[model samples]
Target: MSFEKTWYSLNEAIEKFGLEKGLILKWIEDGLVRAEEIDGKVERVNVDDLDLKVQEMTGI
Candidate 1:
C-alpha cells in the first residue's frame, strides 16, 4: 500500500519545505495555486499546484 498527500496545510508546507509563510501567502494572493481555508483558520494548499510553482521558481 502507498499513501501520498494531495493537499498540505500552510504550516505543513512551510515546515516541510523550509519555505517562508509570506512567500506562500503571496503565491496564494497571486493566484498561482489553489488553497482552501479550513475551520476558518488553517489553510491547505494543493500539492500539485505547489510543486509546479516550486519547479517554476527553481527552474527545475
Candidate 2:
C-alpha cells in the first residue's frame, strides 16, 4: 500500500515536472487518482499518486 503526504497544483506539476495535464485529467476522469476540487475544478494533484504515476510512466 502507498501513502500520500504532499500536494501540487496541476499546472505546477505539469509545467515544472513535464507531466501531461490532459492525461492526468483523464486519469481523474477514470478514477485512477484523486483530485482536490474547488468550485467544480481540480485544484491540485495528490503528490504521492503523481509520484506513482511518474514512476510507472518512466519505469523509475
Candidate 3:
C-alpha cells in the first residue's frame, strides 16, 4: 500500500484510528503533528507523520 500522497483530515484521522477527536486535536494543539492548511483554510494532517506520532505516543 502507498503511504505517500494520502493526507487525512482531522475527522478522518479520528475515525480511521478509532481515536478521540479531542486527542487528535490535542496533538495539533501540542504541535506533536504538523498541520497543514490546504485550499487556504482546510486543516489536514499527513498520514505518515500521524503514523509516526502514534508509535511515539503509544510506544508500540
Candidate 4:
C-alpha cells in the first residue's frame, strides 16, 4: 500500500523493500516473488504480488 509503482526492477525493489539486493534475488530464488524478463536480461518485479507479500509479512 505504501508503494506507487506497478512494476519494479530488482534494484528498485531492493530500495523500496528496504532490503539488500541479494535478499531480493533470494526471494526470486525462493519463489517468494516472480520476476519477468522485460528486455533481454532486464527483469520487472510483480508489484502486486510483492505488495501482497509485504502485507502478509507486516500484517498490514
TM-score per candidate, in order?
0.79, 0.77, 0.67, 0.64
Model 1, runs deviating above 4 Å? 1-3, 38-42
* Candidate 3 lDDT by residue in tens digits, 28-50: 77887777875855378767767
Number of clashing pairs per prediction, in order: 0, 0, 0, 0
RMSD, model 1, all Cα superposed? 2.3
Better of 1 and 3 by lDDT: 1
Q: Rank the candidates by lDDT, best first.
A: 1, 2, 3, 4
Q: How far in Å is the alpha carbon of 27 misplaced in model 1?
A: 0.7
- Candidate achieving higher lDDT, 1 or 2: 1
Residue pairs of candidate 2 with colliding backbone atoms = none
> Model 1, 2-56: lDDT tens per residue?
4889789888888877788888888888999789976865479877788888899
Best model number under lDDT? 1
lDDT of 4 by residue, 1-60 (tens): 565668898778777877677766677778987888656453888777777877888999
The digit string of per-residue lDDT tens for model 2 on 3-39 reads: 6447788887787568678888987888877789999
Better model by TM-score, 1 or 2?
Answer: 1
Lowest lDDT sum, 10 consecutive residues, model 3, at: 38-47
